[model samples]
Target: MGLSALFRRKPHERAGFELYGKAVAAARDPWFFGPLGVPDSLDGRFDLVGLHVALLIRRLRKDPDRRGAALAQAVFDAMFADMDINLREMGVSDLSVGKRVRAMWEAFHGRAQAYEAAIEAGDAAALAAALQRNVWRAEGDATPEARLLAGQAMRVAAALAEQPFAALLRGEARFPVPEVPADAA
Candidate 1:
């Protein structure tokens, strides 16, 4: 996909070319399109996050050498700890915020383990196929994480740079996190 397409903002999350009111500070940077995104505005940004997180989770699962693992962990660190603390300034409840963080952590660990296992077994085709399914640039347009996992794999850990206020509360995470991919043992 073209760079413009990859960087295209979600309409529901944006008020025209601008972001969804800048309700979220993290939404303003490239990282928001990172792992799950440092979500600033809660508009379509919420949807972008799930796709990104799922892709990240899948990538981690296939990493036998733990590539980009620390950064993934760090994304959670900021959300569950740092970012969560910061958003408290905005009047969001701690419990609600905590649930969101926990859900994201679950998705990340679950998908990561599954995808990493696939790669370790020399299943490039399977890995690619799995990634293709997660690609946001497809039929309906991509979300934050999907765009991130599209091609390159580095610059991923810091991808989240920070998690938004509601990464796990929507989309794929809302759907039901598979402990392992259906075809896996």
Candidate 2:
């Protein structure tokens, strides 16, 4: 094998990386920060990324074929791979990278389950509560913006649902642009 061949990703992994990139971009949308009250901090960004990734995984799992499940796993691995690189770039010691990545994986797992359950149940209140806790780090009650964000998430899920599985398999995902709620703005 050529030396460069070692660095090449499998087709599915390449698609997974592309899909994860789209999710990250969607999560970083300024509308989320301005109107939805998603914090622009690291924790906020992580939570948003986790939420988007979870949504994609949920959709992938719906396919009756094995490709969906495989792609979902690849996407998850791609995310943690990125996370490892990010931690190193941020000057985190190599010794701590494993621990940090593990912690992040746990956090992502918990949030994904909560988001999946709420969205699948079509329970906006539960989704809002989960978002409020993770995105806003709030307690007691969900804020109006949290509720609005939950609505936007539902819209995102519906939009994703409308997309063809073939498109997703080809590493393309489309997210609807979020609108500022009248009251939120």
Candidate 3:
């Protein structure tokens, strides 16, 4: 590649990382753990981050430009790199980190597929069920929190759908803040 092309690529890569950071920040919002009842634990946080990233990636994949696809891959790479660092900080042994990361990747893909299908079907019940199974891992009937979380996810997906492709390409994506239900207050 020419030097000018290489230089231009760096900005897009940086933008991808910046966008990934936004996803992580949204996932770590205290409302999710408090009113939303998303468990405030490592796994819970990881799942939230994964969900946001998946939604963004899905949107990026729909863009007509090839740059969107490249940025999406960059975001994915950044997410996994952050995961690896997090695992080490959590005291996971280096030897086992790869195995654990692999498992996490599998979980991510599974959740992404399920979420994509549910979102595409435009069925709230299906989305709730998928959220219950993946996010809450609840058995039997869905819990109230699972339903609330499903509502939040649906809102996020809708908000993302409305975002202009130009903004997304510029890494200016934003997810609407989930409103806490009145009953939860």
Candidate 4:
């Protein structure tokens, strides 16, 4: 279904889907990704950026007009993610580039720099092992708190749909920005 339907919150009713609505809600809120798209649960700056950017992209699609600081931040975050991915891809070693590439397949997967270093050092076996391990998966099911936050973010995103474009692309800051906000604290 189109985002129009996605953003169009239905009547108060329990959904058949397990917290899908909550997920949608979480993606909308500006604060969902933490300060300046910093990954609350992972390593690296771009990771957070990509997360927020992805959410912003969804929100923008639903309502292009409501592109604000959050959307702008998201775009910037996405761009950074792309750059990091490209850099990480490039720095991969010939011996294990393929292995590392496969291991790094997950979108929101977390990992230590050692893995990247292994890829850079050309350890195909390590990279392959890492990929096969799939270490990021949690043992139990997703927490109720997570689902609630996601739903809230989705609702926030839906509400933020009517923003303006200029806000997202304001100033000269585009790619490789030095600072996102003057004082986010």
Q: How would you encode candidate 4's per-residue C-alpha lDDT over 1-185 as one tens digit per residue?
A: 87699777432112211122223333334553554332345333333333334444444444435434344334434444444466566675566655654444344334323234433455544433432232223234434333333333333343444444443333211222122233334
Clashes of 2: 0
The candidate that wins on lDDT is 2
Off by over 4 Å in 3: 1-11
lDDT of 2 by residue, 1-185 (tens): 99899998765898899999999999999988876667889899999999889989888888776799998988898999999999999999999999999999999999999998999999999999999998888886888888888898898888887788899999999988887766657
User: What are the TM-scores, per candidate, against the unseen true structure?
Assistant: 0.35, 0.93, 0.89, 0.34
Which segments of candidate 4 are over 4 A away from where they belong? 1-48, 63-136, 139-141, 169-185
* Reference-based lDDT, residue 10, model 1: 42
lDDT of each: 0.39, 0.89, 0.83, 0.38
* Model 2 worst lDDT run, 10 consecutive residues: 176-185
* Candidate 3, residue 102: lDDT: 96
The most accurate candidate by TM-score is: 2
In model 3, the worst 10-residue window by lDDT is 6-15
lDDT of 1 by residue, 1-185 (tens): 88899887442222211111211232234443443433345424443343344344443333444433443343334334543664577777877887766665575455555445544465544444444443322434344344333322223322422333134212111221212223322
